[model samples]
Target: MSEDIDSRRDDSGATAPAPRVAVEPTPQAPAGQAQPGPEAATPGAATQPPFNAGNPYAAQTQTVAHTVVKTKTKKLPVFLCSLAGMVVGAVLVVALIMTGALNVNRDAGTATATSEPSGGSQTIKIDAEDTTLAEAVSAKALPSVVSITAWSSGSSENVMQGDDSEASGSIGSGVVLDTDGNILTNNHVVEGATDITVSLNGESYEAELVGADTSSDLAVIKLKDVDAKNLTPIEVGDSDDLSVGEWVMAIGSPFGNEQSVSTGIVSSLYRSTALPTTSGTYIYANMIQTDAAINPGNSGGALVNDNGELVGINSIIESYSGSSSGVGFAIPSNYAVKIAKQIIGGKTPEHAYLGVRLGTVTASNARQNNLSVNEGAYVGEVIAGSPADEAGIKKGDVVTKVNDEQISSADSLIIALRSYDVGDTVTLTVQRGKNEKKIDVKLGSDADAQTSQGEETNTDSAEGAGNGMSEEEFLEYLRELMGNGGNNRQ
Candidate 1:
């Protein structure tokens, strides 16, 4: 009833709901009006405008329109694609199952697939026989291998030093060389032994030293009053036949353990090292190197090849631990035989006394020194009253040959001289000025031979000439790696 009545609606006179209007498509267009085509009513096409109720005639001109969408054409392409994809998936699934689960390559006799390791190399197992060549060699050589016990009044300091007390003894191994109970072992093994006991095949016999050479580190001892009916010496093998990779076995008493055997390959050949034996310092040349575990007690033991032949004598080891560091040196059987033979013949082996300062005669030296031959030991100085001087050998006289052996270097002369006894006469082919002459000179004793070195010896030695050791305890040991017979190797 107030001033706000004019802005309000009248509810008493409210009209009924307007009738809903419906629109329809026109059947035809007037001459001047344009008409829609069939595409105008298609899905997602132009839509209709709002219906008009004020003009009934306008409503009558509208007609309802309907359009049908064809879905079969689109669905036909999808069905074909699905069928092709299912066939390809089945083929891939079958191939994967064959390789992963079936292990199909085994049935096809296929080669194994190889793959490189991530970081390091891959190894394959190789089949090898259970038996070794060392077994046969040891069996054949063990019978000839003997255990030696040395008793001395001096302090008990020797290789293979036994359980015997300081005032008692030492122990080592030796090889039997002959049927007469002669054994061959290192000179140091019985070096200072006042008494020696040789045990062979469980029978022990008293031994006497026959001959010992300190220079060569070798000695021969004899088993006194023992039965030699079944005794067989070791078989000697050629050391020259030893190749660097050939198999070798060591038969000896290591740490007083008798009949202990170790096997290895020849690591090297022709090694020269100065060793301290029972006698003195000796230069061992043309030696065999092996890793066959040569220990302190193994000294004077046998170093045999695969055929059980004695190729070397285990003497010294080059080590800092005072044990086998797998680097052991052995005396070549050839040199050992040569030394043993001289000592066994009741003659002391001495270096031949060629009293002259010698030099190697090269082609240059031959031309410069007016030498007749290009190779030989050249005489630089002739000591007065020596074998060379007494034999009319003068300075500048080149020694072309000694006896039947050629003298190429100074060492060859010494080696050739060592092969013979001191009193043995050797023929020397000498070149004086321009003429070649032969002179026979008797080799002198050790005392006289000391001055025979290439350089002038300052002092005269007064020692007597002998095989360095007494033959009373001299026994030779030799074994055949083949049949076990003669014991002498040198």
Candidate 2:
């Protein structure tokens, strides 16, 4: 068991029950045309897929073909970097586990909810054959789907990169957004390409970068010489309206097969993960989780809903083996569209920044720190000029909620902030001592996501720079930073 440390005193010299955040920094749908051909087959693998009608994420003894990883993975912070590497190396340890069964009792109804957590329900009821859903969605979506081949001059990642090395090509996917040929895909797809092309309906056209935001892992590119009148802009759906268990589809070039389609259901919502960049990290917030078989080449493909509307950009998958283990992630369409529009307007996308180092409040830390709650993000150190600092967030402040959304972890805080545009002010509910306080903060702006990671890439800014920092070492570093960080103000 973890050590007990919840008996700490508050600044007011009174006992409290604040929660401590535990840092486990770890890491789509689509629709389109005709009924997908019979399930994809792998040689020397199972002759039949364990995934049949109604089974979205369960398979026993089934193995996928292994391939070399070509995409860039984020560099991890010191403390859990090795742990994270181990986690990534071991993919799909935990399933999203939804419990809101929609009357689909398997053997008859298919998926059944095993149990529910104290809060929130799970899973959607499947109504039709997976093939029928895949076929209808594929037919409706394939027309707008485009195969992207990006040429870069740098070293290659299986997915994408903006390399200036010897010119080479990488394959990804995208969706047509308008008659203007403005297409939406992950930024990594066309990031550093000297030349990019988009193929639709078997005709290829040259494309140019409109704008790309690495922060959200999204980008917008425009096709050259394509008639806007002939474009079939895809229908954009509301991700906020999505629920667990809803059927979804993914269409892309997985392993370079164009228009390859897979069917699954929404696994969970508002998921968070950080990708290592040389500068620091790219944090993906409010993401959609599915088991739609997103593979390396599907980086910028479409995650569409049953209505054949775009819901997310199929992006990363959680697997230790570097292959699709049926646990995949997507950039929520709302954020994708929000950033895409900003890029289209010729401005870099901006995310709301709090400028504070945070720690997760767990039961032990809550008792140790005398906190009132057993879950929340504990404010360790606030940046001097940051919005949170200006708003009076101080060291030791436990933030329990952001604009009424209960913050259960540090990742939750990041997820809440990602939903807002920079310059938008919001309320923060903080548990200070014996009383709760609501502070309205005007969020500040940070540059759109960048291509590199930074010095503070570890679990929290409070831990200082470098890799492999233990908790005791992190506390010592935090003290040193506080001593030199100036600003003794509460």
Candidate 3:
């Protein structure tokens, strides 16, 4: 419960909801491509991975994977980190109950309410007799997946002097969004990068950063020196149509290996977790969980269905040895596209904000606190003049639902809020003592909340550092700060 307040206050830069998932801490390669060294450490910092003295941009090692784990009985410690050259950590807890039916039903509602892409029209129906399903999908989707390399210059003056040694870079993957040369990848992949290069079909071109949103861990980069006509855009799909046990393919670079493909099944859906970083806590809600072998350098890669249609963005993985433990997560295409569009439109990506401290409702806590509900989001503190306070939501209120969606725990509440955008109106069902009441509150923007509260919006300005720490040092620090155990692959 104390951890809940520490994690959830990020809505106002005070505290925010923490994430769960236990793997190991490992740095993400630029495109899931293999670097010229042994496996790097996971970003959760459970254990330190061997550092390659030759490669300064090696992945950091740590314990737990990058996703936060929440159970009805307890909330596990979240060690979610970025998988890029910077330490990316997420935890994998097998204790999670696979909620397939719940995800399908929830996503069904999203499909009707949101104008997401229906890739059914573009889904390629291949005759299994003619070729294997993987072969067909790979042939169609291979052109749409590209390898990305993000370079960070040590000094502006040194970069101008053509000092390549002073520059550090990481590898990750990207999905071609359009023929206009727009590509979508994880923000962590490109964060702190001054130079970016994209490799497509064995050709390389320079790219420019369009924009980034740290809260959602999504970013858009545009090719600056490439011909749009030569680009092949990937067919987008409706992620709300996904079901548990469905076949999916992960295409990306792992350990600098470009255009690699791995097969797996959708293990779970609607997985909500957060990665607390020096910049801020990244909320990964309503995610697609799969058993695909997502490894370091697979960040920003493509997670497609058998039809070669893009369904999600490969982002994080869970492992204890800084390798794949058959637990990986992706951002659903619907939400990823929504955030990407906002960045492309030159708008700062915003997350819905409900200014209130949260604690998970559990049997022990409920009994100790004399609460009626055993499962729900218990309000600990409400920020003054914030949405929750403005709506007359009092402390100790147990939020059970958001509109038709049931809020089973504090994490669920965070996940539900993510389904909505800033300025959207939502009806929150609360349990006060034995009385139940519904409160309508217009959601506010986290960006606005930060501004009003005079919080730092710049990611580089975090951790009392005016200039952000280098990716290499950041990973080392993450391993130490988070803990020294488990080695995550991504």
lDDT top scorer: 3
Tens-digit per-residue lDDT, 1-490, candidate 3: 0001111111112321233568887876789665664676554456556776887887765555567887663333232222432332212222222533222222211111111221211234444446677888797788888898887766434655888687776788898887678899988788888888889999988888998877678999999877765777888888999999999999998878899999999999987765555555566788899998887778899999977788999887654334466888899998999889888777767788888766677677789989988888878777778888899999889999999999866655766788787789999999999999999999887765544434544433221101122344334433433342422222
The per-candidate count of clashes, in order, stands at: 38, 68, 90
For model 1, what is the error of residue 205's alpha carbon versus the real structure, in angstroms, after optimal superposition? 1.9
Error (Å) of candidate 2 at residue 108 is 31
Question: For residues 338-424, could you state the per-residue lDDT of candidate 2 as single tens digits?
Answer: 788888887757778777777777787778878888888778777777788889888878889988788876655765787787789
Best by TM-score: 3
What shift in Å separates residue 47 of candidate 1 from its native position after superposition?
Answer: 59
Better of 1 and 3 by TM-score: 3
Which 10 successive residues of model 1 have the least lDDT summed? 1-10
Off by over 4 Å in 2: 1-133, 154-165, 357-386, 395-400, 403-411, 421-425, 429-438, 447-490
Task: List runs of model 1 lying over 4 Å from the truth.
Answer: 1-131, 154-168, 276-279, 350-353, 356-490
**Which TM-score value belongs to model 1?**
0.51
Q: What is the lDDT of residue 17 in candidate 2?
A: 30
Error of 3 at 6 (Å): 23
lDDT of 1 by residue, 1-490 (tens): 0000010000112122233558987667778754677655554454556667788567444345678887656788798999999999989879887779644333212111111111111122222244345655665678777888777775334424654445555567887776777778887678777888877878878889998876667888989997766466777778989999999999887767778899999999876533222233354666899989887677788999877778898877744335576887788887786667777777765554556655556677578866678876666676677776788887777777887778765434544566666578889898877798999988776644432321443323211121121111111100111112211112
Which is better, 2 or 3, measured by lDDT? 3
Error of 3 at 249 (Å): 1.0
